[model samples]
Target: MRPICLPERVAARAFPPLAPIAFACSLALQLSPARAQNALSVEPDTTAGSVPLRVLDARVRLGGERVRLPGRENMGLAGLTELLNVGGEWWVGPGVYGAATGHRGGLFVPGVEGAWSHPFNDWLAVDTGVFAGGGGGAAAPVGGGLMLRPHVDLVFRFPGFYTGPTFSKVWFTSGQINSNQFGWMLNVDSSFRYRPADFHGTATDGSATGLGFDHVDATVTMARPRNSTSTAGTPMTQRIGLVGLRAERSVDGPFWAGIEAAGAGSGGVAGYAEVLGTAGLRFPVVGDRLSLGVRGAVGLGGGGAIDTGGGLLVKASAGMTLRLTDTLGIGAELGLVDAPDGHYKAETAAVSLNWALDVPQRDLSDWFNTRPGTPTRMEFGTGVERYRAARKDGRTEALEAVVLQVNRFVAPDVYLTGQAHSAFAGGAGAYSVGLFGIGAQMPVSQRVRLGAEALAGAAGGGGVDTQGGAVLQARAYADVALTDSLSLRVAAGKIKSVHGGLDAPVVDAALVFSFGVDHKH
Candidate 1:
């Protein structure tokens, strides 16, 4: 059965009250002097005379709210962001929000956000923020899925964290969801050291200090549904195929923590997804070459007709990892997944290829230490794209997306990129794409360059027939320098499913930020 599309009348109801709220908050942030002086401060000795890129703030927020999903029901969203201080009392960065309530599990939104914060005294402060993004899933009634959320919080400050009560409003520009709710929030403070974009040198000391993660893994998973029941109490029989990404950092001797997010790419369950927090302990069996581990995770998951009441799930696994190199490993796991409040049970097996990063951990009070002469050049950006005449469920329509990307220069005129696209228009709110590949460029002038790229990734959902979710895309782009560290880019591209009937012409525009970091080899 096909899902219902949103009503056309919701498009005209875009909220107008946000402009004043945004303006007032901006004014308050600009006039405040409370959080300006030591915004990016680190220890004086190791960071002296160094002009490195800095992570001004890293925060994780968990919140809950109730919405009108045909009836009043609870929803939870978790947020993470790495912000850079722009000026006095203001910070801006990229952030992602995902459903953690399990009731409507497949919700994911990737967006850009800004915040204003000021201290009232030594122990109390106010923080306000606004997020703009696009996404939808689980047949939710978010038309076009362009979502906006604005929030205000009053927090009690501690040494390295804050606890607060928050009030927020969530609205969709072309959808039938307008919700206001109050929730509790917790925020942690953190920082990391990095290098400048123009850095091209060799490190003398054996140390690294950029991108605080220690490891990343790409996973392919297969699950056998056991005793699973549909939302309507019907019997279900389907095997699920999922692709996922995991990132983690060590906390103590053998303990580590991380985040994992995955989506179903096959098995007729396109809109099923989960975002979870994981912790584990690893013990070496063969002196850094082989290891065994046990991991446990809990989070929200639903959608795809699997009944996960409130969307909460827990999983446990045992695995072994074999080190192929100093920086790479392969692993396999056997696990049990269960939804306590819903009728879902599964036994899963997964294989993963992982890469190791050596960035050391730094606390909120300390700065990252990078060895001099490390060479890392990169660009990060966010923008929008439009797909003309995309094929979905035997029909064709235009779709719009919010895109986030990172480019790492391997040579002066050559680079590699990773990108994500989330659909927000044309009744395709649940559709998304992830891609990685290579590109080349040359300078036409001091301010302009042209380039082309080819990429392949997995995409599904929104009833788009991606047939196992493999896709390829190629694009040509023009970039114009706006400043030494910023540029404006526009591109035209073609995207096609490898085994399905989704072929579309895509056009995009974005603003890119360039940074460089020095690290040890």
Candidate 2:
């Protein structure tokens, strides 16, 4: 904490009736002359200025009402809310608030909140920030999930403690035909603050102040994942490997927030690029050699690793760093990350090299952010199929089919499809059908891919007596990539052969060979 005494404000603001806590703060700041200004006796020493920029705190946030989900049972505010937070805050630039852990919604209101703060004096400050991210199913509401929080507080400098009231409201960008839900609580916190220059001994000039410099970081990650909503009969993806990069600076005092980019599930079934916003606080742990901190983050991207094909996600983690030299340090963390579709709940471990660009040495505010890789791709293939046809004329026959198809990805996990197929039997003439429509896909791991598609097109051949008609089809399949240019798939689907006068139901199994086309942004 800085030892400088602050000058008192000119007047006291009236306390509002809704918050008794704010009323107490107003009274204290108004009546306590000894503490209203110059509340501490510590002196500022230029020789002792190398203190690491930091902010650490723990609090229990009350999420107080019940939120109604579409089909699942309603959950109380406590259930929809985060339970507690054991993390640090970055007060640098715009400010960052985060906490990574076993589950996401249990702290810091379920995701990273970027807010700004202003200190009135040595004894008071206020903060405001917002949170918006997506992952999970409709159980979390539609694609746009959002939260906002505003805070007010009083500080006690001597023993390093603070207390205040915080309020919040959360809702979906959509859904919630009922109403929005709000939560509030009393935040009692203890924090340790520091900055990079604080470790540089008295280098009070240049980049150490982070005034005109850039902050950069690089790291490698490994995580063990559990299958995302896959059943006992489906293929599964169980792990991921990632390499990442970050660039950010403090907007507030010790709070750092920014975007991070990474490539996970490479050289396997999990191949895609992702980007997310991450934030956290860095505080002093062992003078100049060690540092400990907590981090919170959320992001969106596409890859099989993201079970919903491509969607929003949340992650929570804590880590430590050992400074090896002025601009070089190594760190690692353990945390959990989950996807929106409930496809993956990965337990992760990562190691990184933390550095500052300038020669004087500075601590770069760490916030996690991300950018998505090419989540869109194309597939075209041909396969052999078999089906039993029950004709309207009361004739039933077994047939052989030659099926050709093309699929195009339009979103992270959705696709548009078109296909043509021909069937032949000993006494029966050739039967053909063409189809067009949309579908969805999911990656179970690096090698397995699963999806389903629907299409409608023109039908002709002897089955239609040369008078072509319309045909509709729906199919689901599982794929195993055999090589960079090859993949094999197994599928089953229902075909409505209305044009062929064999309209009841036709089912077929196909052995397909697939190759990809470019994924242009």
Candidate 3:
């Protein structure tokens, strides 16, 4: 087998004071309101006549312990958040995010948001929301102000609808605001959804696979953010925004595929529209209580800061909901994140706990359609390899190898996996044995994981071995799940092998590309 080339550990240093300063002036918006206040409430409103319609409820949170940026003297927090809700003809919420892992006094901000929804009946609803807010940390010179925004949303259920307009503006405190800083956003989106009872031989509700008319959605958006630097002792910012669209289709139970396009620029209008595409699978495990999924995407675009161009993003996640009683339940999520560019990305594994209030018991069909419970599935892969002997006059050989892996829950904190490698070279067919192992997967975040494994396998006839030997390995794998199936994996491992009276030590590193399934139970 070819030796796995490990990636060098790139120290995650603190961000430069100037970088945070630049981001603050460019993207700083607002502090996220606490979740305790926003979580969905089950309290019945006697004044409203009936329980309000649960139109939408979604929350995303990202952060970890304090860490320093590269070549910077600042120590701050790193995290992101996005939340939204539409109920009883009113839509209210906020989308707040920031990277404050730098200066002693970091920057923080939250944008304003509001929306009005009008239900024309049980099937159609028209809604519009606006947001405006901005702030800088203790580093602000003028205490910074807010940016006003206005946008609308139209919803059509079952058959769905497409083609609507969205407009927004960033009104700054003064003209001194960078050119790249001030601009507008214009967007149009159209989507169609279909959920048929049955299609072909695949039942839309069972059998781990569903078939229906492919769903499609298209969106185009334009934005401009000032991007400039001080030249004559005056701060200058440039203005830029990319326009792009994405289309996707989800088969009821098993798989989905999507593609996206967008322009790039720190200021003004982007010159190139970057394109990304992905496809993957999903499956359920543990009697519909857990799901497993994986996915990968490739970027095709320009390079440099103007683009960083394109690369890859991948992730995998598994989740389960525990019912404590009829009306209350608890849930958990564990996953990974990985990206090629560390500056714009980093791999992470995360786990979260949530409590559900007054959740209704889902039927088999509804359970199959909803995607909230999924398991983490192990991935197996194979590739070619070449080995160079250590002694002089030693021959160089090319080999083909197959790798097998299985990731599943063996118990509460323990996970089991097995792998085997077979190779062929020269006139001899050498197989490096089968590896049976088990370990614990400790989640640190939505994109990072720490694991250890022990194995014993036999070598099929490669000179230095007899029968089978034992090996112990510890590995850290960082993964980023961009979608249900596509994910990027960066891992490092150290192993010690003992056989026939001799012990050999080995170290391996790999930047692996993975594509697989993500399913919800």
- All candidates' lDDT scores? 0.68, 0.43, 0.31
Runs of candidate 1 with Cα error greater than 4 angstroms are: 1-55, 204-208, 359-373, 389-393, 407-417, 437-452, 517-521
Please give, for residues 188-298, the per-residue lDDT of candidate 3 as tens digits. Answer: 111111111111121111111111112222222222212322212233233333223333445334655544343322232112223344444546555544445554444
Better of 2 and 3 by lDDT: 2
Model 3 alpha-carbon miss at residue 385, Å: 60
Best by TM-score: 1
lDDT of 1 by residue, 1-521 (tens): 66543321211121111112222222222221113224434542233234433444444444444444546655565555556667788978787666655366667777888889899998899999998888877667788888898999887898856766777888877887788866655555544345556544444232223444457787888888899887778866888888777767565578776767676667766557776767788999999889999998776566666776666678899999998866568999999998887788999999998765443212112123322334446688899999864455578888888999877564566776777788878777777776777888888998898989998777776777676677789999999999877899999999998778889898999998877544333
TM-score each candidate: 0.82, 0.32, 0.26
Per-residue lDDT tens digits for candidate 2, residues 1-521, read 66542211101111111123222322222222222123333542322234323222322221133344456434333211111122234331111122111121211122333344455677776655454322222123322222333333332222333334334444534334233443333333322122321032333312112111134566667777665433222445545566566545443444555556554323232223344556677777688679887776665433322443224467788999887765567889999877653466678899987754333211122111112121123455655555565543567656554555655444446765555454423222224444567888798997788988876544432222212244467778887777643577877877664334544344454433332211111
Which portions of model 2 show Cα errors greater than 4 Å? 1-66, 72-139, 143-168, 177-202, 205-217, 226-235, 243-325, 329-351, 356-521
Q: Model 2: how far is 46 from its true place, Å?
A: 9.3
Give the lDDT ranking, best first: 1, 2, 3
Cα lDDT of model 3 overall? 0.31
lDDT of 2 at 500: 48
Structural RMSD, model 1: 9.7
